[model samples]
Target: MQTDEEIGKVAAAVPVIISRALELFLESLLKKACQVTQSRNAKTMTTSHLKQCIELEQQFDFLKDLVASVPDMQGDGEDNHVDGDKGPRRGRKPGSSGRKNGGTGSKGKDKKLSGTDSEQEDESEDTDTDGEEETPQLPPQASHPPAHFQSTPRPLSSRCRG
Candidate 1:
C-alpha cells in the first residue's frame, strides 16, 4: 500500500504526465511526416498523413472503452480524491478577494439630465445669436438624400419644426 504523501505526489503529477505523454505520442506519429512533406515541397501536411493518424472509428472505440472503464471526471490508474474547489459559482456575487468597486457609477439618479440646461440649449438655437439667418434647409432629393438618411418618410411634425 502506498503512503498518503506518495499518493498525493502522484495525483498532483497526473495532469502533467498525461500532457507530456500526449505530446510525445503526437511527435512520434509526425516523425516521418516532415521529411515526406519536405521532399514534396508541400506547405502543409498531406491528406494521406492526416488519414493515417486519425482513424475515427478506432478513436471512438478507444474513447468509448475508456469512458466505460472510468466513467468520471477523475481518470483511471489512481484515485485522486481532490476536494471540491471553493471558488464562486457562475454569476454569483463577487467575493472579498482584494476587489473593490469604490462605490462609483452604480446610482442612476446622478445621470438624469437637468431641465434648465435643455431649455437653454433650445433658446440659443431659436435665437441664432450669431446674426446669421437660419436658412431653410431645402427638401432633400427623393433619389439622392444625404448618405446617412434612410429611405423612410419623416413625420410632418418632425419636418416642419420652426
Candidate 2:
C-alpha cells in the first residue's frame, strides 16, 4: 500500500534518526567520561578513564569495545595499536555461525540439564516410572488471610446511625 518514493523517504530517514540518537547518547557518555577523567585529576580525557567509566557503569557496559586503547608511544615494535579514527572491526570472527554451544542448537539445553542437580532429581523421579520425565510441580502457595478480614471492624459513627 506504500509508494516507492514514500518507502525510499522512510528508508533514508531511518539512518538519520538512528545517527542523531547515537550522537546524543555519545555526547552524554563523553560528558560523563570527562567528569570521570576530572575526578582522577587528569587534564586530558584518556581511553583508560573512559574504559574505567564504562566498566563501572552498567548502562555503558555495551560501549566497552567501542572505546579502543591508545597505542603505546614507546614503540615496542609491536602492532598492538588500533587507529582512533577507525573503530574496532564489527561482526563475528571467522568460523563463528553466531550460535552458542558450537551451533548444536537445542542440544545445548540437554547438555546444561545433564549437569544440574534438578535434572538428577528429575531422572531419579522418572526411574520409578516408564523413564518418562514428569513435569515438576511448583511449591504450594502459602495462603494468608486478607488484611480487612483479619482486622477488627471499625465502629460506625453516630451521624451514619441517624
Candidate 3:
C-alpha cells in the first residue's frame, strides 16, 4: 500500500509461491531468449530476441500482446505474426483462403472482368442522373432471432420425474 492507501494483507505463503513461480518463468524466458540470441549470432539479448521466444512456443502464447510491440528488422508485418514462427496454420499458404477477404487478400492479384461485365460498366457510366449523383441501394440485411427465443424440451431425470 502507498502512503495514504489502505494496507491489504496477504498470506506469507502466497509471496513464496508467487516468487517461486516468477523465478521459474524468468528462467524459462531467459533460456528461450538466449537461444534466440544465439540463433541470430548476436552476443547480447535484444527485445526482438525475447519477442521471438514468446512467438516460438505455445506456452508463451499469453505474452503475445506484450511482445507484439517489439519491432523486428524485417518489415514482415503482422501477417506472419498471427500464426507465429510455424508460418500459416493448417499447412495453408500465406496468401491463401485463411484470409478474411475470400482469399482475395491485399496480396491477391486484381481479376480482369470481361464479356457482359464490361458492358454493364459502360452502361453505369452512361447513366444520366440529372444533376444528382446516383446512390447505390443496398439490400436489406438479414436478422437472426436470439437462441433463447426457442425452448427445447429436456428428458426428466429418474430422481425428479413427475
Best-matching candidate per TM-score: 3
TM-score (C-alpha) between model 1 and the true structure: 0.25
Please provide TM-scores, in order, for all candidate models, with all chains considered together: 0.25, 0.34, 0.40
Could you tell me the lDDT of residue 49 within candidate 1?
A: 34
Best candidate, lDDT? 3
lDDT of each residue in 65-103, candidate 2, tens digit only: 776463322232322223454432344445543343333
- In the range 1-162, model 3's lDDT, one tens digit per residue, is 224457667667887898999999999999988887776655446678788889998899999999788886344342223223543233334433333323232223222332356644643453333433234433212112224555575666744866
The residue pairs found clashing in candidate 3 are none
In terms of TM-score, how similar is model 3 to the real structure?
A: 0.40
Q: Write the per-residue lDDT of candidate 1 for residues 23-139, one digit (tens) a residue.
A: 986685465545444544444454433333333335424434333433232222222232363422223134322112332211221222324566445434543324232444332
Q: Considering summed lDDT, which 10 consecutive residues are worst modelled in model 3? A: 137-146
Q: By descending TM-score, how would the candidates be arranged? A: 3, 2, 1
Clashing pairs in 2: none
Evaluate all candidate structures by whole-model CA lDDT and list the values in order.
Answer: 0.41, 0.53, 0.57
Error of 2 at 31 (Å): 0.9
- Model 1: colliding residue pairs: none
